[model samples]
Target: MNQAPLPSYAPLAEVVRSGMREGVHYGAVVGLSAEGEVAYARGPVHDAMFPRSSAKPFQALAALRAGAPLEGTSLAIAAGSHGGEDFHAAETERILAAAGLTAEALRCPPAVPGGAAARKAFLAAGRSPERRYMNCSGKHAGMLAACVAQGWSTDDYLDPEHPLQVLVREATEDMCGERIAHTAVDGCGAPQLAVSLVGLARGIQGMRLSPEGSSERTIIEAMSAHPEYVSGTDRIDTELMTRMPGLVSKIGADGVLVLNVPTGETVAVKISDGDAEERARVLVGLTALRGLGVDVAPVKEHLTTPIQGGGRTVGEVRGL
Candidate 1:
């Protein structure tokens, strides 16, 4: 196994147990000032990193710009990394139905639901995983709908040179205010763009600050208004959006998260040791919010990660 070279990343969070330092999470997490400058950077802010599902909002915006008739929860699902709950699946299905398509059209691989409870219930009911239950089906569905609406080829919609992808690239560059340095296949089979941590922060900020009727604003509003569709019941995105009204929040796979407040404060975090641990990423995001004077009093319980020991209480991981 190859470990990341030292010095490229600084300590962004720590994993402790029983008053001992068990591990350290090295990564880049940044807070963007209102002027679009990097005010605080824990690591290399401009290093090219995949935005993962964090790119969904802008991708959904691209689909909207292409004339996909997404609105309300439909729009939210399009931009969400849903927990694969029943309602999430229903909305995703609705998008495909409206596109004159069905689950067989989804190219993303089949998988169990992202939510633990949903997966348990699905398995208990003697069902197998399906594409519609995949966490990113909503994103893929939205892209298909856009291709159909624009008369573009839905089969090759994920292709980088496809018409829909061309618009997606344009939308990302336009909103992030930075040229995407590279493109790669996302876990869900969509094209993911590489941009700086600060770029991600600035991009999400645009969602909040863009004109009310613009595509960016529409997606942000939908994500905020229907937080449950954006993620699921009690998930981080849904919980945070509900607690912090007017916040546009999204979490991507492999320890990626972006938080944006209505007041224009924005944060983006990437765990340099990607997939090191899922428990610490949200804590880091909340800590970054504290840097911007956003008091997370309502979410005080989330500030620490509880370490379980044989089903008993143990130590926890807390943001530095």
Candidate 2:
């Protein structure tokens, strides 16, 4: 392992209060990978960090490798943090049904749909949140499917010692090229692994470069083909993948964003303040890609945010 001393974070973006001469908010950016190597890096790349929902792709891949019968939108959702639209919920139900289970089998806490319109409709119908509407339902359903296929008990599938979870840990280790430094319960009640940012980038690159017809490759293709299922309409992940061909992107909670471009470039960014206000994370990631001579013009507008005061545009938050 090429571990190096942790370095201080450098300013990657600045948020200026309206008409202010100085920035009120500052963020740090770390590493960039290309052609299977860490081409650029700053700050501490070896510090343990939780990738959060961004780890879904690897988790879904683990299920597939364990013989879960998932494909197309099902596979995509397995690797997604879906917005819980009607289609997303229905699809979650379908996966559960295919595995001889029900939404009640999911261990994730019940939650309303993440989509604004869907939430309004669900509320209008006098419905309470259900496990099926949880953003992680698809992932949980996939775990159940894998358990059923492997003859593993589904009762405690979310437990770290469960067969399915063991597979997830193994797969994560394989993809990231490092042992997990720590594990903890995720917001969705699944076991989350802590790995270095460099390891996270390596994992994403490994997934992107998986051989054709392999389970990992299947996940990559499924997510790329069904970007909407990976997130939802107007979401950052969905919009980024839709506009950028052959690009794989996932955003974790707390301001972590990872991107894998077609040319074998991988970028991982973390915001120290854990806030993405003004699209700062996206802008920083784009700026890193732009530095590598990647054409980012197509999505630049989408990632740029205008600073406003009293409903009037003032300054703008931009990448440094």
Candidate 3:
């Protein structure tokens, strides 16, 4: 637990500028470090509430490390996902089968995949909608498999009181280096935890430092190795991993972004007012990572600053 150096940037000015953004006033905390020490911390480092989808890497890893027997597309789908294509659907089925389960066993809501093309394809193919097609279904399937491996009951698996959740909480704390201070329901009808930016950064660092075959490490590797499954082609997470070597990133609902660089730098950002349009999470995250010495050329090249009507630049966004 190395103490972070005081940020050279003035927090008062930073918060004020962020608050003035057109969409919503945003609050963020970023952590950057190498080895086991914290190099910098900004904004409110604690008390940020974010859903758990961003933490899916750790959850999926728990199943892999426990020897649930998944690999190839199945492993890729488990680690990285937005649930939009045939490959994703097939992989979800594969994981379910490997666990001696079926689509019926999934507790996630039934829906077509995320992208418009994926949904159109599903309808055109006359494939009846099933829970397995849901993007988060792969994650849920992986969790259930982990529970099965440990001989935990499959019923009420999504319950906050479930033993699997207890394990998840422990693993999450281990990765973030802090206990979850708040809890809520996720869009997938599963438990979500609230964590600080500092905690999220610590978690990313933990994932990078975690041992091979350890659940946390396994997930970080899988997602890093198969970024496309985590999101789709042209998706932020997918593109970031594809373009930036040795970096893994994920975005949560409500303008949340987390990034881990190969140099062991970790960053967590939350748009305070939750602006869906300004994409303040990406803007600030890319800016911060660039400042911390991440190779941001590709990001700037692929993700350009937006130009306004007068041919003046309004805002900029870095690619994945």
Per-residue lDDT of 266 in model 2 = 81
Candidate 3 residue-wise lDDT, 1-320, digit = tens = 78455323222112112224332234665767666455555566666567457777666656665556766456557655575677777778878787888888888888887766787778988877778778788788887787778788887888988877777777778777788877788888778887777787888788888776765666677777888788776477887888887778887777677888877877777765554653456657777777676767877743333524456655544322
Q: Indicate the worst ten consecutive residues by lDDT in candidate 2.
A: 24-33
Model 2 gets an lDDT of 0.82
Clash count in backbone of candidate 1: 0
Clashing pairs in 2: none
Candidate 2 local lDDT, 1-320, one digit each (tens):
87654445566666665756456334445445566666766556677788888889889988998899999999999999999898999999999999899988999999999877888888999999899899999999999999999999998999999988999999999999999988999989999998877888888888878788988888988888999899888678898899997788888887788887866688887776676452677887777767666788879784556777899877777665
Q: TM-score of every model?
A: 0.95, 0.93, 0.84
lDDT tens readout by residue for model 1, 160-269? 99998889999989888899988889988888898888888988888788898988888998999999999988588899899988887898877789988877788999
Candidate with the greatest TM-score versus the true structure: 1
Q: Which window of ten consecutive residues has the lowest lDDT sum in model 3?
A: 10-19
Candidate 2 regions exceeding 4 Å error are 1-7, 21-33, 276-278
Which is better, 1 or 2, measured by lDDT? 1
For model 1, the run of ten residues with the poorest summed lDDT: 3-12
Number of residue pairs clashing in candidate 3, backbone atoms closer than 3 angstroms, sequence gap of 3 or more or interchain: 9
Report, for every candidate in turn, its global Cα lDDT versus the true structure.
0.86, 0.82, 0.70
Which one is best on lDDT? 1
The predictions' CA RMSDs to the true structure, in order, are: 2.2, 3.2, 5.7
RMSD of 2: 3.2
